[model samples]
Target: MSPNRALQRNISFYDATNPQEALGGVVQNGSITEANFLDILGILLVVDGVSPLRAQGRMSNHIVSRRDVPLKTGVYNIYCDASIQISNEPWIQRLVSRFAYREKDTFRREISNRDRKCVISGIVNPESSIQAGNWAGFKAAHIFPLEREGHWIQYDYGRWITDMDDAPRSSKISSSQNGILLLAHVHQVFQQYLISVNPDDGYKVVVFDLDRFGLDGKILDPLCRSPDDPHHASDELLRWHFRQSVLANMRGAGEPIFEHDFPPETDMVGEILAGHYGQERFDLDITDRLR
Candidate 1:
């Protein structure tokens, strides 16, 4: 559960030898332009900042495989290799925010104020407050959650993905634009669905839901609707619900879904801060600064 495990980063390579190569690299086909080149390099910079630099010198990194490149006038060629690079920057921030002192609480407040509903659920419980639960708080759910580990600190998913398999797709956890706040139950339910939503407009999005019972109440039903639109339950939310219910269909599977504590409920942030700063220092009382 330590953030040490969740930190991930990597850099990928692509062959620009032909149009097909560009398509495979980013799922797009076009004449590589200066802007596109900068975009690629910009992403590379992020990867380099987090991943180890290697001198390929023309050797293929072998991240991706061969793909098709089509040109105008009925011309097609396959002359480049598709590869991916990833890093664990955003993932680490998520872990830190989940476990960091003061950061978690403050983040929750910010998100709660934005959508008013629990990020995990579309409903906002009037009883929810920071002084109610362990810290008198409602849950500030992760759009992309941070799974647990040994001591329940904060683990990075990007790190896991990179280590388990070298891929360009990196884990996104922070980017305030990507999070939501929900009541505790709603948060639990959202976690159950393995899907999250945008309060402004219900967008059906997928998440790696790792729970047995889903957020809405029962096992997921792919034919159901998305949790979006508090008014009518959006299709996106329904799809997510169904997918999660199906995911929980482990009647014959060996690897059952695992359960662990998430933020607001667990004492991970408290423990991590207490261990780092000592309980005495953590409990210290302070006054105003500008006197």
Candidate 2:
């Protein structure tokens, strides 16, 4: 959502920092980073489950080449430290990396322990990648987001503990309750309000298309239910996410939404579904499949 820029500046527009400042660009040469060719909207744009990598190639200069470093057992394109935290490379911005490292260390591990793996990424062996911090392309993303009672809420959920013997409300705002481990691409779209996870009757994925671009779609259901952990995706949190991504915005708000949580599927009327060789409408020949 484009909040009135007149009211705020840096990072006010969704996960975007600033339209004028197309961050995340690393210049190969002094003259060109992908920043020269993009804006914030273009940076966050996704098409068919992938961001536009073609534009990145178009800006690549022949003179600017990357030096090859010796491989260090990388997985998920991340390398972890001994603490199972994804170690940050020099490339990540200092200010941002500081907080992210904390998130990577604690958030990733906590959610993995509770949910048992990356919920959205579906990595069966997420543990193997954790020790190496070379995760299998998953991110410990905040569900409610990092805004101050605006597009999202600015709650520091990192320090939340599972033992709710003291304060029950603390666990409610914890990332372990509302946050999720999504694939990098999935996290990107999620941060930008492109998709949401619905965890009611069954796990369901919802996508939003504000521009009518038909980018809306679904992936495999996340299917997470941690009975042991007090901090899995709460139904309240899921509805909040849906309201942000669907109901209050692009998709119809009045639409009766449910994650297949309604009453059990009913069989179609047997006689009406039956086929008849005779012209008489009531002369029915029901098959076992209809039973």
Query: Any runs in candidate 2 off by more than 4 Å, and if so which?
Result: 1-104, 125-127, 149-165, 168-172, 209-223, 247-291
Which regions in candidate 1 have their CA more than 4 angstroms from the true location? 1-103, 119-121, 125-137, 147-172, 192-255, 259-291
Best by TM-score: 2
Clashes of 1: 42
Worst 10 residues of 1 by lDDT: 3-12
Q: Pick the lDDT winner.
A: 2
RMSD (Å) of each candidate, 1 decimal: 16.8, 22.6
lDDT of 2 by residue, 1-291 (tens): 122112211111111222232222211111122232232223233333333322212122122113222111111111112112111221100111112223535566776655555565455545566566565666666676432212222343333334443654433444566577766666665654546654532444544323122223333324444555466555566655654443222211111111111234533233223422122212211211121
Each model's lDDT comes to: 0.31, 0.37
How close to the true structure is residue 98 of candidate 1, measured as C-alpha lDDT? Answer: 20
Give the lDDT of residue 247 in candidate 1: 30
